[model samples]
Each structure stands twice: as C-alpha cells, then as structure tokens.
Target: MGSSASKAALAATTEEPMEPGPKHLADLTQYINETHMSVAHLADILSKKTGSSSWVVVFKALVTVHHLMVHGNERFIRHLAARHSLFTLHNFLDKSVGEGYAMSIFIRRYSRYLNERSLAYRQIACDITKVKRGASGVMRNMDTDRLLHTLPVIQTQLDALLSFAADPDELRNGIVRAAFRLLLKDSLRLFAAYNEGMLNLLGKYFDMRRSQCRESLELYAKFLARTAKLTRFLRVAEQVGIDRNSIPHLTQAPCSLLEALQQHLASLEEKKDFLCPCGLQHTVTLSIPYRPTGNACARRTWFADYFPYTIFTLPSPQACWSRAAKYGASIETDASGGTNWQLSTCASTSAIWTSVSGPPSPHTVTSTMAFPPLMSPQSLVSSPPGLMADELELTAWAGQQSQSM
Candidate 1:
C-alpha cells in the first residue's frame, strides 16, 4: 500500500464507528419526545418484551421504554390521554414480576418514573382528593383494566426499585438532588393520600422485601430537618421527576393518601400555639378579673390568634374594666376577657384606692359597685371613647349636683 493508504487503513481500523443495524437504529432516538402516544407505544413495546421468553428482547424493550419515557416529546402529551397511558404503563409494571431479574430492573426504572410523576401533584393533591371520590365510572373502570393479581404486582416492582435505589450520587449524578425532592414530595402525598391501598404499598416496600423505604424516609427526614436550618422553602421536584402540580384526582376514597396527609398536617399546624407576625419577639401582658361580667363577663379567655401592628381602641374600656374587676383582677394572669390583644399593667394601690375614696356617688355606681353609666350600645358603637368620656363626666357631675341638692 502507498503511505497515504497505510495511514487511512490504520485510521479506519482504530476509529471506525460500528454501523448500527436497522433494528438498533430504530430503537434509538437522538431527541427525547414527551408525546403521550409515543410514550404509550414505547410502554406497550416494553410490556410485550417484559412478557417475552427471551431476556435480550426484554432488556432492549426496557431500554427503549426508558429512552422514550424520559426523552420523548413532552408536547405530545397534550394530544395523548395522560390517564390512559399511565394506566397502561402501570399495567406493564405490574406484569413485570413474572419476567425475572431483568424485568425487575425495568420495573425499578419505571418506579423512578412513577415517583417522579407522583411528585407533580404536590400542591394539588388535596384538591384532587376532593374530586377523587364520586368520580365517573369511566375513571374507575380505567384502573380495572387488569385483574387484582396483575395490578398488585406493582407493589413488588416498587419493592425491587427500593432495593436497587442508591443514594443518588451528587458527584456524577447530581440528579439525585432532584430525586430527593421528588421523593420528599411523594412522601408528602403518601402521607396525605395514605389510604389502605397506599399504606399497604408503602408497607410492602418498607416491611416485606427491602429496607430502602425506611432508609429513604430517614434520609428525607434528615434532609427536611436540615431544610429547617434554612428559612426558605426549596423546590426540587424536577430532579425527582415529579410535576409538583400534576396531581390528578380521579376518585375520593375515604382512606386515600391525601386524607392521611391532611390529617397529619392539620395536627401539626394546630400544635403551634404562638405566631410571631413580624418574625420578631415581644411581650404582651393581659389581666383577668376574679368575676368578669356583662359583655366582659361573657368573655372567657383571650389568646392571640394573629398579631396586631398597633393597639386598637376599644369602644368601652370601662365595660372591659367591669369584666376584669369581677375576676378580682390578677397581675399573674396572662389573659383577659377580650379576644382583642390589649396591653395591661397592674394599677398602683393608690390608683385603685383613689377611685373608691369619694365613690359615694350612689347613682353612678351600680348595685355591683361597677360603673352603671346609662350609655347605650349604639352610642358606644358610634362615639366610643368620646361617648365614654362624656358619660363618665356626666355621671360625676350629676352625683355632685345630687350632693348639693
């Protein structure tokens, strides 16, 4: 050979690309599409292969499904029946059990996808749960495509995924961070939608075969706890493959994952007795009387529901005082009769004694020894402080005139 021919021959032998056959080329796509029909087609192909007697066929099918599922044209989903494809995909996952170890790998891959998709409904799970019950027959019928035996097989698939799931490597696979977030969202949904079926599903993965369910829970707990160290809520849904807003509620069963989560979160939020509105700490003192009466007497206990930036004026401070006096006002009490937050401090002995010293103003004092000024509720509602001051001054002046008479 000539020198040029020799160099060309060496280059061809060393760097030649293996020409992919037509079948292999058919299975591979350069760009992943997110179309529903394409995804369904890919899944159907996978299901058929998963049921195949040949391991190579099953493996190739799984590769094809994974490729299409992740990289398929997302826009195609608009034209596809999302619900139908999910059901079909889930069905394939169910039958994967009989397909052996390779099948298990495919199921695990599908589980990752499921985990991702489930996360998409994080914000709307409750809304979906509301519509979950009383769904149309068509919706219910869709899930019934497979027999119970085939359907329940997904629990095992989930179990296998848990077994093989690793701590998503952040170095090479920083995608695990997103996975963690998606898993966290899934955990929330599982807690919210915790029905017998889902609980059983979680139980299967946690108790029956592998410990990864428990491990993931622990890892998530640690992650969330660490999140508490930071003030802002973070978004990690896409990492885990969840939509965070795609929760679809097809029915409303009593024991759904949404219900469980709602109950759990309700209990948690209720346990918080205090709220710092401005994220600042300040003290508020309230005094309760020994025998509160009238409107004030009707008042039981006061607790701050929300913080007020400034003090609000009451229509009748005396009415409040009369209520407080009934209880023989105590400084130690943290609460008073009104729901409105009011700042209080103990009155000096002189302030109390001075009011009582000349109080032979019999007409102004009621039989209960509290102010009995004849101010109507309407007048109290209208003028408030001015009306109250006028009433008190008139009462004192009337008493002095009566003394002179």
Candidate 2:
C-alpha cells in the first residue's frame, strides 16, 4: 500500500463509525493482509491513535484495529499478539473536555481487552498449528490445561468489555456507541468460547481441581447476573442507535440459558471431590483443640468430641488439651468476634468458630472460643440459633468448676 493511500485511510477514521468507509477499510486491510504494508508500520499508527488525547480518535483507532483483526491478515494478528507492548494502552487518557465523550474509561478497558483477545487468538492458532503438525494425543491433555488457563482471561476480557455494562447513560456516549459496535461484536464470540469451554471442562474433565471448578462457576454466575441486568441496557441500545444486527447474540442469549448452564456446572462440581474450607484445600491447617476445664469465660465452637470428618479445620483432640493450657477458654468471657474469613468450620459440627486468642488454629478449640458479640441475634448470624442460650447454660455449668482442670 502506498504511504499516501495508507495516510488517507488513517485520516478517514474519525468519530463517525463509517467515516473510514468500508472501501478505505477494505483497501487498508488488503495492504496489511497481503503484505504491501508492514505490520510494524500499522502497529505504530495504531499505538499512537489509541494513545491519543481525544477519546474519539482512540475509539476510532480501536475500531480500526478490531476491523483488521476480524477481516485483516493472520500475520497482523500474530505480530500484534507477540508485540503486546505496541498496544498495551495501559495509561491511555482522554483529555476532551465534555460530558459527551464519556468513553475514556471504556476505551482504556476495551483496548486492554483487545490485547488479551489478540493473545488468546494467537494461543488458539498455535493449538490448531499443533494439530496440523500431527501433534500426538499426548498434547491433548496439555491443550486442555491451556484452554482452562484461557477461561479466566476470556472472563476478565468480557468483564472489562462491560465497563458501562448496565448504565444506559454512559452507553449513550458517541464514543461508547461506536466502541460497543465492535466491542460487543467480539464479546459475543468470546462469550461463546467461554461457555463452550466451561461445558467441556465440566463434562469431559471430571477430575479438575474442585476449587478451580467452583471458582469458575461463581464467576460464570456473576456473568449471568450481568446479562440479566443488560436487558434494560440493550433496549436503550436500540433507542440510542446501536445496530441490532451487530448485537444479535447479546440480545438473543437469554438469562435462563446462562442460568441453566450455571446449575449444570454446579451439579458437576458437586460430583467432584468435596472442598472443605478447613484450609486443607491449599496448605496445612493448624488444629487448636482447646478444652476449658478450669476457665468459664471462653466461647464454645466446633467442640466435637469425635473429631468426625478429620477436617483440618477441627482442632485435634490432644491439641485441644494442650491448647487449654496455653490460650485457655471461658464460657462467660465476653466473646469478641472476627471476620468470617478468619473463622474456621468444624468438620464434626456445622458451627463456625472464631479464634479469640490468635489465628484460628490448633490452639483455638473449646478453650479459646470467642463468644457472641453483643449477644444479639443480628450479631450472631454466623453462629447457630439459640447459641446464646446454650452458652448461658454452659456458663452456669462452668461457673462452679474448681480453679483447676
């Protein structure tokens, strides 16, 4: 492509979605696809345009990049993915002073998503290449793992795509309008990949890590809620002039469809190994089993005499005795509370125990229990019902104990 022709097409790209009209876009794409233009030259122009102070220019440049990626040459994609710094757009800013161009945040985010998309596509292409090269069946498992890795990348890109997710006001911005035309276009495809891959993961890979599987489902549920919320935004999308054709998937994919998929995933996840919050999912769990024979001020939580499930969250029996001697517990000591994350559940009982002494560990059995805060119903939501009454009764039983174990 002649420098003059390339310059005209770049100049033609303005706020109007069709400004760099199809012909100009076609000719420019042809140059990059056919190698008449160097990928480096296109990269430099895209970098500068995306990094512009004007949000309009940035949005248009992003559209151009999207255009070429969708309709341009394969080499261009590889070059962009490998040379990610060329389009990082991490600090891209919009200095246009107006309420209309409320797209700086959206543009910055969309640009990053595009970068991830490019990288993701490159990985996909590599997998295809491996297949064509007659890669052995051994590569299959490795590829599955790679796709699992890509799941979150796609999820995050989709999240960023919806920066103005349900906000009709922000979605109305001209830059936002143009950006979504392309952004949603890519998102629809990415959404398919994510949903499909998730199904495969749950269906074919039954042995996948429980924590990863559950976390993926939770993230998927988050997307389902967003889509349900997007219904209103989509109605506004048409009122604001976004093409119905471009967002067919966005408008057609039902929330129920996603919900069913989520439930399926959850059911499949349950069939896998159970993940105990006993902290054993990751590293070692410290069991602080405390028996308060002499003290009456400590809280009583997760005091299972049998150590039922061997859940690491349950303090070991012998450890409880040692813990009684070290930290100590009392039924009447006013219980100070801790955040839920700091609390550990007992495998033997459903009660969640908080460590009044230190991090809930082996040193935190019955002897180190922290009682209910304020002794009010609202303050004890995490604990079982009538826990206050039980603690009071237990306190009465302990008040008469000798000052020795």
Candidate 3:
C-alpha cells in the first residue's frame, strides 16, 4: 500500500496543468471589471486635478479606450459595456471643450489602435453607437451606415468652430480644437473634390487633347491650376499616412505650372496675337513720344502714357541724356563726336533714347531710352521699398482702373 501511494503521488506530480475553463474566465472578467473601475477612479482624480476644460481628460479617456479595444476580447468589451464605460465617455463628451472635436479624437484613436477586421473594432463600434444613441435619439435611429454618416456632421461642426472664431486669440486658446479643425478641413474638402469620377474625367480629357491648340492649352492650364490647388490642400491629408515626414512635391505645383505655361505660350509662333488669361499679350509696349532740342543742355519734356498694371514710366529726355553722358564717359566716341550709350531699363522690354540731328527737323527728333533695372515691376512686386511707396500707389491705382474697366 505504501509503494502504490508513492507511485500515485509521482504520477500526480508529473501531470500537465489543465486549460482554464468557465471558472477562470469568470475570474478574468472580475479582474477586468476591477481594473476598469480603478482606471475610471484614476481618471476622475486626474480630471479634478486638471480643469474640466483641460484636454488631458479627453486624452486620458482616449488612452483607456484604446487599451481596452486593443487588448480586450469580446467578453472584456461586454464587461466594459455593462459597466457603463460608454456613459462615462458620453458624460466627458458633454463637458468637453469641443464635443465634436473630442469625438474626432476618439475616432482617430480607435482607428489607429484597432484593425477593422478585428472583433474589437466591431465591438467598439457597437458600444459607440449605444453611447451616441443614449446621448441623442437621432443616433439611435441610425443604421451603421447612417451612424458613420454623422462623422461629416461632426467634422462640419468642428469646421464651424474654427470659422466662427473672431481672431487668432480664440484659436490660440483652443489649440486642440484648432488643430483638429485644420487637419480635418483640408482632407474633407480634398477628398470631396478629387473623387474617382472627377479623376476619370480629367484623365479622359488629357487623353483626348494632345495638340497645342489654344482651347486645349487653356483647358490644360485650368486643369493644372485645379490640380495644384487640390494638391496643396492634400498636405494635411498626407500627414495622416505612415510616413508623416514625407511631404508631397506638389506644394509649389501651381507656381511651377504658371511658369511653365508662361514659357510655353512665349515659345508659340502665334504668341504675339494670343491673349493670355491674364488679359495681356506676351510682349507689351508703351511708347512716349518726345521732341529733342538742338541745345543738348536743354531739358526736353515728354508726357508718359499710363501703362496698366505696370510701374513703367518714360524718363524725361534730360534724364536720358544725363544717364547717357554718365555711361558714355567710359566708352569710345564715333568720328562725328557722337557717343552711343546702352541703357538697361527696369521694364523687361523697354528702351529710351534721344535723337540729335544737324539739319532741319532736328528740333523734334524722337529718342527711345531704357531705364534702370531698379524701377521694374517685377522688382517692386517682390520687394517694395519705403521709398517706392509712390510706385505701389501707382500700381494700386492701375489695378483699380483695370478692375473698373
């Protein structure tokens, strides 16, 4: 009998442990319930430590939900749901600084932590529906698709929050809400604008137009401009991708396309007659006729015609002569003691000069002169100096006149 008892004891010691059954699962559920309560209590303490308006509450709750969704199975989710975790979330949502904004944060966190194919997503979705329905009867009536449709409504509310701010101070104070609004606004608009149908249409249009015809080129320019605008807005959308640091090269696409179109139009043989979308030809000329006196010392006056949307002005014949004399001193003179000076003007394509003759009709000789590069529209547009306030005034006046026309 002692030998048999020893053998049985040895067999028992060698036996493998049995798998956990219903009793173990019940214990696990109890443990999860206790853990969830502890987390809720901690969150309440933290919320009291931080102000109710503080985003910390929202962040902490999001972390809790993420943990539960990622690690907890269906039974754990059911336990959380039974403990009214959704009600806690709903209460937090109500008191939060931006309710819609907070919801978006929750959605993004859930999407990041739980895979759609996983049971956790579906469980969380159901719990979210329940919480949403409890808060609003409208959500209770909604099917899953309809419930998902409310995401845009929340997005629109967040956008309205951003738009309604009177100044930057309001946005500064609500940085979290502002960030959510900015991040969502561009993405929503871009996705709506660049749908599959629009893409297919654009592709077909491109394939149909291969020639350099004016209509085709005009359409191409429009397409490029639209594409550039959409692409620029997509910067925020692309931030949500796995590689956050990688920025798309299309940020400056509009500027590049404009420059390219300008070059292409300039290269065309019929460019002279082609009226650009900007309502100006490739080359624009403004002539100011002036009469020159026999006495080279005399200050000849010329009236400048106003050039639309340009800072260009015709210099007086005396000014031209002064510039010529200044430049001519460094150069060689011809046999007739006449000096030719090459003048560089601010206008991309303008020249000014004086004509002197010894015979009759020499009194009113026309002179074409070029001004300095400093006075060009491009330079003024780029960096208008304090001394160039008059030029800016002229440009503004010209712009008003053109708009009125």
Top TM-score hit? 2
Q: Candidate 2 lDDT, tens digit per residue, 84-169?
A: 36565667665656642446666667777677667665665532211211112212224446655666666665666555453556
Off by over 4 Å in 2: 2-5, 14-19, 88-93, 99-101, 122-144, 164-175, 205-405
* lDDT tens per residue, model 3, 1-405: 323323322222221222112232233334444543333333233223222333443443333333333233444445343442232233333243354464444434332322221232234344231131111233324433343334333323223322322222222323333233333332332222222212222222212322332333454344333433333333333433312222222211111223323333344433533332321111111122333222212211111121111122334434434443432311223345443332222111122222221112112322222211121122222221111112212222222332221
- Stretches > 4 Å off in candidate 1: 1-43, 53-56, 76-99, 102-405
lDDT, candidate 3, residue 60?
Answer: 32
What lDDT is obtained when candidate 2 is compared to the true structure?
0.45
lDDT of 1 by residue, 1-405 (tens): 123322322222221122112233233332223222333443343354446443334334443433333333443222232444332233333333353443434445544455334333232222111122111311122222221222223233223223334332321232223233333332332222222222223223212212333332322222222212111111222233434233111111111122222222233333313221112111222233232222311321211101110012233445544543444432121234222211122100001111111111212222111110111212222222111122212222222332221
TM-score to true structure, per model = 0.24, 0.51, 0.20
1 against 3, candidate with superior lDDT: 3
TM-score of 2: 0.51
Candidates' C-alpha lDDT:
0.27, 0.45, 0.29
- For model 3 the local lDDT of residue 152 reads 34
Each prediction's number of clashing residue pairs:
43, 20, 8
Q: Candidate 1: lDDT of 177?
A: 32
